[model samples]
Target: MYKAYVFVKRGFVSMLSYRMAFVLTLLGTFVGAAQFYFMAKFLGEGHEFPLLAPYGGNLMGYLIIGTTFMSFVGVSLNSFQGAIRGEQQMGTLEFLLMSDTPLHQILIYSALWNFLYACLSTSVIFLVVVFVLGMDINVNLGAALFILLLSVVCMSGFGLMSAGIIMVTKQGDPITWAFGTLSGLLSGAMFPVELLPPFLRTVAVALPPTHALIALRKTIMVRAGLGEVRSQVLALLALTALTLPIGLVVFRWGFNRARTDGSLAEY
Candidate 1:
């Protein structure tokens, strides 16, 4: 029991030790959000999307929320890659591995709790968007929460998997870019997917976030019921299934490889 407390305490201490980095992280994320807001305000002038008509309005508010939430989702899921890099840098991966408790359980709990903390902190700024900036956000309370939760979990699975890759090769830029850019370009964050070439639109739907962001547009603008979101829901479900299991499986393999190589403690 006391051991569990020590683990939690250690994680918090690690987070605090990098206070400057954390501050930079907070500020940088806020700047990114602001950049998106301005970009949307620019493109939104004197134009309309036909698909957005089903949602009964423009996509500006939807873009604000989508960009904000995707920032969370993108960073959160890819957290594992960054985390493994840190562990390697600390030169404590092996020492930590030697702990009495199961390593998987410890890592999962620590990662998840910190991710939740990120979500809370990010959401505070999101509220500022609607209130301070005076954006007309037609928020649907229930659907917003539901879709947000769905997005978070889906992203986490990707993060854990990416971390596993880092565990093996200690490199992640390629994987991160593969997932991040693909989602960014095709997921309809800045504009509708239909604007992309037909081939790109098809590929975009293959990315669940494409559907997820569209669903968010509908729920916030049209007050879409959960029933109205089967496509988005199913897409997220399928991606979650693929990402989580594969991530965990690869993570197990990577950890074992690190152990055998005596590189578990490599920084």
Candidate 2:
């Protein structure tokens, strides 16, 4: 935990050094939120849309919840890989790998700051959507938080998997790219999965974000309790159980392979 704190502090310092980037990031959050707000208005409330019936029939609310959750999902999916790639680019990955710290811990600790920043960004989006944009949300804060936790853990498994791939490839990562593209398209981030065709809906159901978004929308938009979205909760739990172990194994294997091939320091 202390290591995580140190990493976060370092990241904060880094952000401070890049004031314009930090400022632009915050500005982007507001711009993104406003875009969603206006897009929903242009599309109408969607109360007449059958696919949105279960989610209180509010287009803005659905979009806000989906986009907000996906923001965290984006962090969880890319942060670790980005950390590893950044370290490689800086010629520090090998030294870190040789250290006493377990490789997994190094990667996990490195991404901590990204998750923290994502939380800040997400809060900004939510605030802008609910207050500045006047979007009404009947949210169960406790349940919403729990769902967010589960979603991150579930998605982090995939992040670890991508991080492993980047450790070897040192460049393009098919895992993150494929997941990022497919997730945004099929995970119902901007629309209800019910609108998808049968086979596509099946694929959408298989993605972690789909379940996460459903649970988030239910809990945040309809103020549903944990039990109300228990199915989505269980799906996330199951995915976490299945993916986390696989991610660890894959990462360990990649680390060992890179070390054995004397390519750990190669970029």
Candidate 3:
């Protein structure tokens, strides 16, 4: 509870400090949505001489949502790195490792803060876009929330996997590129998987964001009910069940190994 409240407070304060950043982020997201909306309009209208109609007419709305919600996945992964780096820089990294509080809880809470803030922030902007763009997809909020809950579990688990790497390697640059490139391309942030090549399609399916995007699209674009998105829901559940705990365990091992190596704070 303390950690949750701390993060919530910090998120609010951080937002206050960077009001323009939030606005620009929302604007950029909206622009991306508009670009896709046009592409979908042209191609899906069956007047574009042929290309990407395998994606369905709702592709634009899918693109809009899939791209925007990706920010939350990015957040859940590196939540601990920032605070760890800060503590390390201040010579408290070792102290944290030595403290009574479990590192896993710390990491979980840190990611929770990130996921919570990103989701809450994006949701507001998403609503604004819905109103502003006049998007007409049927949205079942309850189903969407359930899918989102599952996606968060999967995403946060993937994040912990990355955190495991960070704990041992003390390098976030590689992690950044890994998340950025895959999240941008493989997740179909700008287009549907059907629009990608066959080989790329295989790789996209391996990503958690792929299912999250699909689930999100189902709820928002096709407006699929929980009963209808059984596959996506199962994908999310399976990913979360498999990956999240493994990530936590791997991160725990990494942290302990680093401590043994006397490099817990060494970047």
Model 2 residue pairs with clashes: none
Give the alpha carbon lDDT tens digit for every residue of 67-184 in model 1: 7766666665665666567666877666667777687666665566466666666676667666777666565769867877787677667677777777777764455677788888
Q: What is the lDDT of residue 221 in candidate 1?
A: 70
Candidate 3 per-residue lDDT over residues 1-267, each given as its tens digit: 886687578767977799999789767766766787677677667553222232245555666677667776667666666667666777877776676768776666656666776777667656765787666677778898887777777777666667667777787646556766887887777666777889988888777788877777767766678887788788778878888888778777777788788888887
Q: By lDDT, highest first, what's the ranking?
A: 2, 1, 3
Count clashing pairs, candidate 3: 1
Candidate 2 local lDDT, 1-267, one digit each (tens): 887888899899999999999999899878888888898998884437668778888888888777877778888888888887788788988788778888778877887788888888888788877777788889999999899988898988888888788778878878788878889999989887777899998988778999989988888888999999999999999999999898888777777778888887777
Off by over 4 Å in 2: 45-47
TM-score of each: 0.83, 0.95, 0.81
- Top lDDT: which candidate number? 2
Q: RMSD per prediction, one decimal?
A: 3.1, 1.5, 3.3
Winner on TM-score (2 vs 3): 2
Best by TM-score: 2
Candidate 3 weakest lDDT stretch, 10 residues = 48-57
Cα shift from native, residue 44, model 1 (Å): 2.9
The global Cα lDDT (0 to 1) of model 2 is 0.85
Cα deviation at 213, candidate 2, in Å, is 0.2
